[model samples]
Target: MRMSLDLQHLGREEEALQVAEAALTDPWVRHGDRLALQRRVLRLGKPPRRWRRPPWAASAQAEPREVVVSATMIKGAAGFKSCFVVPPARNGSGGGGGGGGGATGVPRTACVEELALLHYGSPAGGGWRGVHSEGGVWTTLWALLCWDVLFMDVPEVFRSPFQTAPLDLDTDAFLPARREAVDARLQLIASGGAPDLIRAVWSRRVGTWCRGVNWERLTLDDLLQIAGCVGGLGLSVVCRLLCEDAGGWRGGMPDLLLWRPERGDAMVSEVKGPRDRLSDQQRAWLAALSAAGVRAEVLRVVEAPPPPPLPPPPRPCAECRPAEDGGTQQGTVTTSARSCTAGGKARRRRGAHVCGRRAMAVPIVCEGTEGVTGGCTTDGTGEGAVVAAASVAVEAHSGMEDDRVVINDDDDDGSGGGGEEDQQQLQ
Candidate 1:
């Protein structure tokens, strides 16, 4: 199972799928391992062993809760990788791991979080300092605020001093055993004494090992800042939720913790890229946070449509003062309709010039076959005549190096004048 998860983390989806699928069938795989393997297989786009739910359980269908979903469009810049935004592999390698190691072995610096940090932490985005820990920060705050309640010598819950968390921490028994102490801590947190409790704990046990406290990423000041923004009621609500089912509730906490000290505002945002959807756990967390009066939401990052192509650079009008050479410089004739005066009459046309008495001719070099040489002339001063002459020159020169169209003021139709001088000027 670890091997499969590691492979998935390394972006090797096929091998991860194979390992997870194989692990599901292993007789040695326990119930917990089986569940994990099944989830992995499903994430890899494979159908796992289908075990039917009990009849009673099957009949119970609950309405889905509404979560606040705010959508924002962001340009899909190059380095932004997200399972939702980026196309997944055929085998489905979508996986994510938070700051504190959990079931999903996704890296802490996953592209989704990086993008969130990039956007939300920038000055243009309210300049909120963001922590990318999915639930590690919340867990740490809970642990710090309830340090004494968790470590209270309950029978069977704390069998060894070496254990980071209580024996029944992941089980339902831990809460029941420590309900009294848990309630006391909750009351204290609700009464706005969370910061004091956290400071006391940090002062006493700064370097001590604890279950969910990430000393490396979080500091004393960081915890205080969080406590300040996530006031008594908000922290109390979140702590109670974690206390009820720390194992399950901690898994789907929002991906970002954004707070502005100056404004004293904080919010948790779960970023969803193009095709991402809220998981059942995430929905529950969002609903719970909203109910508790904490700002929690699903930030849907949409891919902004490509910017409209830039208009071609402005070119000199056909009627613009001609160059001193009296010959049109080598440039492609654009298909733009413009109004120009030709001999005291205004004419609007496409790729047609009205250069008055100056009479300028634009030459086109058509490269064709290698050896044969030739030249040609065409009537009319429109660009069509120029194109027609170039085509004729290409057809005549089977393997020629250069073939061109020449125009002079005397010959308004651009006919004849195909010789060494025209060829030299064309060259």
Candidate 2:
């Protein structure tokens, strides 16, 4: 940060601004340092002001976002190896590991998480802070809390608020006895004795949470489903928030809350990206959450990477061996070791492109026999098979190569009986 200022002091205004902007985007920099750098970048500009949203999104400021995963895809092919095989994750591959690493098994999951950190970007018309929005997990956490705290029918007294709410009961009282007893907290809310307390705490955070809980996007059934996975972590997280100084903690929150459906395991997860830093508010929330016995984690999500490519299929080549009867004969009859397919017949591919057509043109190298026949044979008859393999006699031609000569078997209809035939050169 001082360096950028120094650059500016030296009359390198543009260079200073450049340094500030670059520093703002580097994730490895400490969160505090990155924020200072961001401010520096803005201040270095023509007019010093906080960053603003793009012009187009100004109209939609009033809109609340739906708390659902948007349909997305892996658009990058970088480090993309193969298509089918998934590789094991590299150690420390994905992200800063958090929580006790419980039922969430394996590092491949980490690899997946890392991939996202490396690539995800938002368009110019994206969330206020780059592409990612911090307060993302608010709903999932709320939904979980609702499930836990409202397990038994929510007391009618608790549902509606009164003038002198939370008269006697406060977080100080609630935090003492049922502090770690998740069931006790649930029972207290359900029995209606703690109406004022529940109301007070819930109300404290409701205004902030409402920003993300989009009613239009969540169906009644979806809410019901989410409610079940809402566990102890959910309840404790909100209580921790309500107990804190609201002024410091409204917007600095984690982005994701995840749960395993089968076990109902839950986590308070944060996505920390490059050039991104964990804010003090977020750290305070996490500390409070831990003291309350809630499971908290800093996690990441990423695109599944591709596998490595296979070596190019061995190039088609020929191996030759000496033939019988002195003068050589040649044909490397490569056959399938096993049937290529079963039931459905394999379609015969057309000939390789050669000889100015979609077929090979071979010359009959009549070394000693009269003539050779060629064409595919079936049921003792042939078409496109190398017919009647006869060792045709050939006068030692002057312009012949020593190694095997490639010739088309007798696929042509012409008849030349081997005696001094002007051997048309085999292509």
Candidate 3:
């Protein structure tokens, strides 16, 4: 391909086409290389023979499954969406629903996986228990189930006793070198021996360090549940794929493993935030899991709109008391003939007056039952209250200006009470 590029740069179009065609015809050429050569030949004005994709390439190109969910957005430092709508904390506290930190001292803004897990366990989600380990759990499962095959005696692959993995673990030589052993182990797992192998390995090497195993992530019971759900054939396909290319295929597994222990059902989920998209490696794993008969899907999260704000509190009345007929009225006024009493008759004076500081401006005067037609008035003897018969004009104003009620009393005898002393007494 480089030689063809050089030839094309030199304006030798015929030679470039010839070189690319020759490379494409080579039986040993890699599939990627063949595709490159085919494109190169077409660029140089010559069409190669009809092209076909290799079987592995076709399988790798399969589209992954996708799922989308909306999450309630919370305002906080992390701005994280909760994994569960209501995730149980590490402790038994039930305070994981708000924006503040939970009882675990960790903010309630969990990552995408937690939110997705919560969704699945909710009433709408079929109520499955889930664990989020990204690729660690699956790799650990593979390592334990095929422990013997991985640590078997191979020429020059185990030179060092301290080596956690075989020397050729990431090389192309790893699979072919131990093909027979890997095939035997996969057959054993396919025959329903997966749980036994995993249990034996866990019992034998619980705390011992190994390259792919994560001791802290999976418990014995959890591993057994996973094994039962995936079944023999599905687990075999997974192990075979991992054994094929441990280095290239190890890191892109799903983010969550959800299962219903009672029914022996399971699913794997790869979670993505609003703007996240699947990488090439992730797509490949999803495709392989689907082909292996495992329930696998990509979960995309969308932030939902927040709820409406609460209504304001109710306001307090300026002056309120129960009427004689059992209905309440404001501003010391009542339909019954009752005198307006301000702290008894000692404070009561003949005047046009306002009510409280926050009260509306309702100018009411109490002369007598004949003089007070609108508002209440005292009997001046301090015995009882009175509702005057005279019509008193009351102005309805909302706020106070300098805390003063301006009264234009037309009384000539100076008993209308608009002086500063009368204002102070009313206040």
Best by TM-score: 3
Candidate 1 lDDT, 309-331, residue by residue in tens: 99976444332434674544333
- Which model scores highest in lDDT? 3
List pairs with backbone clashes in candidate 1. 97-106, 369-399, 369-400, 370-399, 371-399
Q: What is the C-alpha local distance difference test score of candidate 3?
A: 0.64
RMSD of 2: 19.4
* Counted clashes in each candidate structure: 5, 29, 16
Cα lDDT over the full model 2: 0.37
Candidate 3 Cα outliers beyond 4 Å, as residue runs = 1-63, 74-107, 306-427
**What lDDT tens digits, residue by residue, belong to model 2 across residues 24-48?**
6675463234445654565566444
What shift in Å separates residue 47 of candidate 1 from its native position after superposition? 34
Kindly give the stretch of ten consecutive residues in candidate 1 with the minimal lDDT sum.
339-348
| Distance from true location, Cα of 330 in model 1, Å | 12
What digit string (tens of lDDT, one per residue) describes model 3 on residues 150-192? 8888899888788899989987789999899999999999999
TM-score of 2: 0.30
lDDT, ranked from best to worst = 3, 1, 2
lDDT of every model, 2 decimals: 0.58, 0.37, 0.64
